[model samples]
Target: MVLALGGLAVLALWGLDAVRIQPNRIVSGTGHGLIEALGTGPALLVMLPLALVMALAWRPTRGREALMLMLVTAMLAAMPWALSLFIGQFIDDPGGAARAAVSGASWLVGFALILMLIDLRQRLQPGALVTLVLIAVSLGSLGVAFGRGALDSLALVQEYEVRRAAFAEAIVNHLILVGVAVGASLVLALGLALWMRRVAGVRQGVLGVLSFIQTIPSLALFGLLLAPLAWLASRFPLLSDLGIQGIGWAPALLALVGYSLLPMTRNTFIALDGVDPDVIEAARGMGLAPLQVFFQVRLPLALPLLIEGIRITTVQAIGLAAVAALIGAGGLGTFIFQGLGQAAMNLVMLGALPIVLMAMLVDALLKALADAARRGDADDRTG
Candidate 1:
């Protein structure tokens, strides 16, 4: 109710401009509010019914689901039309060329609508939510495609258009950096964690070192790796040929691995150590050797938490990879830095939004894996 009311208030009191229009790529200009952009008739037509549905959703009733679905459907239906109307206005403008960029108000409304739909999905079955999401994605894709011309007019889209190849390459480079760093960190951390479980003295030392590394800021860590990497590259032409430059991927990757080690190691250590001693004893009594007990019992029991560590590490690395762009290791952060340099907010969002979405998507996937593993563990115990 509170959220719905807040959204309603925003829609009513705040300017609801979906996107800004600029005369050219270089200029930043004002956008039209929802009412202004779409005209009072269309804007009110959507807003009034949306507000009503939201308010009614607060009460428990048989029709609540229906109402929620109706609201979502309405928003989805209106999206393309709203975008078309906004774009159509600029078509006849005296300006020879104009750019259309998403506005803050538009973002606010879109976020509000998405949040409401997500909340509503909580009441739905998993299959239903999945269907809803697929439908939404399909419609949203169509809407964006229909409005592609308007989108291209946006400064951010223009930036993407100009550097499409770089953008694609950046995504690949970012994924490679994250994948290698997280994968390496997980392998090393698991080994350290398993060793630490058996040796108390080494546990503290290893953990302390990793914790200290985590305390070092990411930029400082990147800076710290520069000298040794530079020396290695200088001493070995082979290393240089393999792209082990001081300022590019090598230091960035090393820094990401360093940052990832703490969470990966800590979670793994805790998960392994926390395994039930009674369970281990039972496994041993079943004639299992020490290796079998450790691998078949301890590791399986700890798998979920280990996966959780991977999840945390992967999400963290994705965000940090953006910063890697600063050192010539290109990723979405290239667009971000370029946007900042050009004072283009939309361009910054172009880079930042993908990073955010990637993190969210990865987190969701790993979370599902962890949940499944946990459920399997529970079923095993019950059986």
Candidate 2:
């Protein structure tokens, strides 16, 4: 049955192309969407089976069975893209309309594949090979199509040979901004929370200040940094050179880090405060110093809530980082702002889409970390 379907799909593709099929230009009028579709389509396919298989572990279904069904569903969804390409290749006098239709059809196919894989995995069994094939096909296509400029929304690849470098650079910049902002926030927040807990009035006073900072809009915060940072820059030649980058990564990062402090600090303080006095007193009785008692006794018990705060702060910061582009912080936001300036919806979509994916990924990772912390704490308490 699978063989029959595959044969039919191939025949259908050939027939469609014979009729003058065309590709869509959703992201770029100059074949950029086609490149992206070619590059990313396979990745999605491979991921389909993996996601389905993992989901099965959490449900009543067997993993292998769930995977097979998902693969079948994904293959069917991919059919439209194949058929559309065939039609575009063979069609007589194919126009932009053909490309648009193909693009729309491809989106539908992708969406359907995902929905079926997820839905079937939850309700019934699928095969492991199915998922594996989906992943292979998607990833293979991506590799084959990526370097030719089909993986991008911009089609200057033929004219400019520097796109690979540009893409790599963009990826690096985004990683650095997100990494520095989130990492610094975590370290500072934790250290401040620990020290504030030791000080009698410092916790309340500091928390209030952080809360106030949180209320200030991100744009205003970035603007506000210019004066002090600039003044410092003037006082120190090295600092002045750094401030010349101005509204870019530095100011944006500073703003994001500052914004993240409130949630993390608040969560840490609350978690520490909620720790049982009995545990602290016992630790003291055991001859542990105040620092040791707080670290060994209270912190372990309070870690789960503290982690939850970190998760929230990280997600919030990702969204706020988009605004940093206003200050010359180059990120996915560059695409968005550029699109807005040029009145290009496709550019906006390209920029906005990646940011959404990045945010979701960060949120998921942090949530998983928090869950692990909670589970570990539970195990330790029980043991």
Maximum-TM-score candidate: 1
lDDT, residue 158, model 2? 19
lDDT of 2 by residue, 145-239 (tens): 54443423221221123244654565567767877987898889888887897787897789889999999998899999867766666678886
Model 1 vs. true fold: TM:
0.89
The worst-scoring run of ten residues by lDDT in candidate 1 lies at 5-14
Worst 10-residue lDDT window for candidate 2 reads 151-160
Q: Which lDDT tens digits does candidate 1 get at residues 1-383?
A: 52464466466424656677887766887777777655778767657756666567667465776566556656655665566566667756422467677777666766666666666666654474676564667467545655656344555666677777988888888899999999999999989997997788898899899999999988788888888999999999999999998989999998999999999999999999899999999999999999999899999999999999999999999998998888888888888998899887777887898899899989988998999999999999999
Per-candidate Cα RMSD to the true structure, in Å, reads: 2.9, 8.6
Give the best candidate by lDDT: 1
Tell me how candidate 2 scores on lDDT: 0.63
lDDT comparing candidate 1 with the true structure? 0.79
